[model samples]
Target chain A: MAKKFLQRLGLKDKLLAIIVPLLVLAAWQGAVSQKLCSELILTPPLTLLNTLLELAQSGDLTLNILASLKRVMIGFLLGGTSGFVIGILMALSPFLNRIFGPLIKALQQVPEFAWMPLIIMFLGIDEFAKYFFVAIGAFYPMVLNTYQGVSGVPEKYHELARVFDYKSFRYLFKVIIPSALPSIITGIRLSLGLSWMFVVGAELFGSDSGVGYLMTWGRAVFQIDLVMAGLILVGVIGFAMNFLLERAEKQFLLWREPVDGRPA
Target chain B: MSNNKGTLEIRNLSKSFIVDNSPLQILNNINLTVTSGSFVSIVGSSGCGKTTLLRIILGLENHYDGEALMDGKQIVGPGTNRGIVFQDHRLLPWLTVGENVAFGLDKLNRKEKKLLVDEHLQLVGLIGFESVYPSQLSGGMAQRVAIARALANKPEMLLLDEPLGALDALTRMYMQKELERLWQLEKITMIMVTHDIEEAIYLSDKVVIMSSRPGIIKQIIDVSSSRPRDRASSEFMQIKAEILEEFHLGTEYTFAYAI
Candidate 1:
């Protein structure tokens, strides 16, 4: 009876997910309003919402968020395409892998920020440096995932390819790529996430625009509220993008999943 | 050197593998000939290299000691003349059933490819299941799709590596009959490797039994019993006992072991 009642309750995942965040917000508000914590440290949720409104009224939030998003998109595409092509080439030919694999592996081991000094030194604190840094950040995950996906195609499928006498290009497109698509999509998701992170890091080095610059400017002005607002925006937008992409990925690879019964 | 388009000749084929740094022979100088449009089944226990022999004929294993000739040409690597149905369905999971069937027909025009795909799906009794993924299909249905994929290629010989070995008893029996009907309908050369001796006897023109551990053909028994032959008949039991004697599983041998 209890189980049936629980089933009938029909608590949707979204409803359940919102509960914890709401509780945290309520707790933070209680701490601030009760004067149990420093006001500057634990800004109330309402205060953050008001700060968002003020920033929107000033048009700063919109501009800075747009700037960061633009960098993330451009960098993701640049990194994703090159990584995909190079990954396929390396996976297909051992000679190419032998020549370039070691150097790429070594380069990837170096952190994304480690290249910033040299990048900024050559290109200066401009959009170019930010793009380059974010692109490099996105590159490693995409390349590694794509390489794994292509190379790890099952031997059974390869036998089918051989049995059918497929040519090299046809095999690559029809079998290898389709087989590796799930992994490639995983790589893309991870790369987009990393690029988002790197864009902010790049902007923080020195920039006049972007949410990273807003946070830095807020710090310069000693206004902790602005910094909090910037942090909240970054977290929410990043999370929302990731959540949407995951849904899209699932929809795109529907054929990869098994359906229950034959459709009427 | 004879130009028998559908005939296959295996000349003293031998294969060995380096297992744990020691050379272990798998196939021991195997020789067989399959005439055009005939069904030949190879039956043996596991580790007997029965599958290995099928692989050799399928042009999968290249390092074997001898030659496999299909028609007048040497069977070197995988070619268009032979279609293989692996033990597993091995269908591309990302593709729909129709796409999997038409995978090899990329060179053909769209209309021709669609027609062929439809015809083969119909042949395998899966006409309405064209849009579903392989994962959605049951084991038997997926196996049928695999067979359809192979048949769509129009190969001279169909190589089966225990295709129905994974099915339940009822499905296995049904598929055995379906396979026989398919063979009769297609009238193409078929070489199947199976563990079910009854399956071998019911479908093939001849049943070739192999002994395990460096596998060799111990005997080739021609099952000239009529189409859809009775499984419970005394003649069938006699042949079954004869095969059991070769495997040392006959009643007399069992009684001897018990004593």
Candidate 2:
């Protein structure tokens, strides 16, 4: 009986969510038919859909998708790993925090795209430059999140672990890391989003291939359809990445739920 | 480490907390001994340093003067031999019930660790909840899991800092009975710090009544009742009255209040 009520509540929420998006899409299609705005300013939804279909049929789309994905994966791994290590070190020792904290914070203040010119100058407008930008974009969030996660662990849990004779690595991995994971996940989500933005900006600067480069190519040739396609693809891919991260979070962080069967 | 069996002897134990510019004295000239496998409950008013005393005993606080000797060896820090359950369950939110129980068993092999966790979960009547997380548990249930986790270490002494203070009255009663059963079956020492006077009288072999402010042992009363104490017994009420008077709470406050 209770399960039925909860399922009904869930269905209601799902229905409510679908309603707005569907209405927006319909309004978009109407605006295109009526020529509500200049075609240059606002491409029709059907035209955008048709362009997406054309890209899909051409097979160039796959290469572009793969290029963006590879860059994100590499940059994400490098940035996330380094950030995690440095964050944990900073959390464990005040001396390390004092030495590196100011420098990292200063660097973080500059947006990831702001470093693109310097990176392009140093790395010479190659793939490495793009990867480096994505990495920097991904790095700050990971480190800051990790530091907060580790340092924010309750003193009570530390006391409990000590009483249990958990010292050294045993105490760190078993207690400290697990206690700090929710914050770590939040950081990861933020960095992942930033990486998408950085990869697009990198492609815009001077890449021969990738989604961002394709969008720039379309813009140079006055192929607004292709640009629209690239924009849609980026939005979809970013959304998918975020969705996957949310699912993983639900699976991994079950213990954080409240007593009333709601997510904490 | 010296060996003297399971005697817990505290010699001239004094603890103070630094507040603002001055030191605030908590436990002053505290001296107490708890025999092995004995159930000792310390009852006191609010801010009486009951929790502080427990923290010192558990080796979580080290700024105190004097010594806490477990079996003649001075306690320098927390040890596996002394396990604690705080008023809150304090179960790690990222771990499942079985994993939380196995948190202290980092040294044990996987198979042995699983067995120990399972055994303690069963001991607490939480056998089928092995896969469930702490967030899915009730207040009483979560506290039981905390108890199970502490017991999985097989500690020589279990320090409970008001383990049942957060539970409802009915659940607290149920947990009290369950605790008494576990204490008798496991036969490990228990030192509980609680504000519940009736709970102290009902569960403890000896009740140590403590005074407020600069916390000090006001009286130590030995309950001569047989095991599985009847709450309705006159002897139980009399001891409860005595302990209440020691803290100036009066016998009228002994009537069971919802936890």
Candidate 3:
């Protein structure tokens, strides 16, 4: 009965999700009006909104966003493609799996930021260093997810391929890859989030141009409003990217039945 | 060597499995012959090696010591000439009914593939469900699509491993009639492994009864009844009684321990 009631109140549930955020914003405004927190530390929501508008009007916001987006695209393409290839190869061959499996596991244990200092020293704090960091962040999850996806394909599908006498290429593309696609898409989504997080870490140390750099610049100048605005923009963009990818996943996996047996 | 195009001859077939460091035999000295354009059923209780025998004939298991020959050629491994439908309708979940049927016809041109798939879908009475996915179909419909997929290859011999075993009794009965109709229409050699004695008698030209514990053929009873034979007929009852007697399930047991 409760499930049916909840299902009927779908729109209300969506509205309810925003209630906590609204209450927090109201409390923040109250604190700022009463001067409970200094502007240098907190930078109340209205002041941050004004700073965001000013930055947008001056074109600084668009420039930083474009720069960061460019870095993410290049790093994502290089990391995602290589990881996909390597993952498939490892799953296909036992020799490669045995050789690289332990090495990858060890690398994954090290945080993406841990390599920042050494990478900057090698590449000299240029665009290449940032790209490398983001790529590294994206690569590990992609590889692990792809390997799991490919290896987890049902043995029965392989038997069907054999019975049909399918060619190797056809079998791989039609059976193995499609069967593993849901897991692969999930990995790609995770890598996308990692790339965003790594971009911030990459820019926090030594960069002049990207959204991450803008936040650091605001911190150095003691412009707390600008910093808060930058953080909000980053969060909004990440949320938007995730939403878009979820839609794409739905489009690609139309054949999957909904777990709750709901109509499409 | 059998002169008929679809004749399958199995000779001195035996299979064993390594269980806990000891060799356990599964099928022992099994031999059977299925002629062209005939339906043969292997009926036995679970663990009677009926499925193992089908797997051997399909050439999925090469470890068995025997010769399974089709049209005078020794079977080696899975080939397109032999199509199979497993007990669980192993259709690819990502594909629609039409695509699943066309899966085995990869060598055919696109137009030819479509035509064959459509024809077989119609043959299995699933003509309007071409675009539907397997998950959306009922158990019986899914099994029919599996049948269509198997027949799409136009194989010389079709192997079914209890194809309707997962369906309800009503659906099973309907599918049994459908199987008979399909056999009459297609005229291909078919070998089905089933647990239902009545089902075996209803659809098959010959019922091969097997015994458990290193499974071997106990008897092969030929059904000389004509097509559309009545299930309640005296002849049908006689054949059913004979098969039940082999399994020690005959009517004689009812009065054996009378109070």
DockQ leader: 2
Ranking by TM-score: 3, 1, 2
Q: In candidate 3, which residue ranges exceed 4 Å CA deviation?
A: A1-11, A260-264, B1-3, B253-259
User: Model 3: how far is B226 from its true place, Å?
Assistant: 1.7
**TM-score of candidate 1 chain A against the true chain A:** 0.89
lDDT of 1 by residue, B1-259 (tens): 1135578999898999999999999999898999998999999889999999988888888888887898867878988788888888888888999999998888899999999999999999999999998878888999999999989988888999999998899999999999999888888899999999888888888899999888999999998888897777767777777887788878955333433
Full ranking by lDDT: 3, 1, 2
Best by TM-score: 3
The DockQ ranking, best first, is 2, 3, 1
Off by over 4 Å in 1: A1-14, A35-42, A94-105, A257-264, B1-4, B20-22, B252-259
Docking class of 3: acceptable
TM-score versus the correct structure, for each prediction: 0.91, 0.90, 0.94
Is candidate 2 or 3 superior in TM-score? 3
Query: RMSD in angstroms, all models?
Result: 4.0, 4.5, 3.4
Residue range with the least summed lDDT across 10 consecutive positions in model 1 chain A? A255-264
What TM-score would candidate 2 get against the native?
A: 0.90
Clashing pairs in 3: none
lDDT of 2 by residue, B8-43 (tens): 898898899999989999999888999988889998
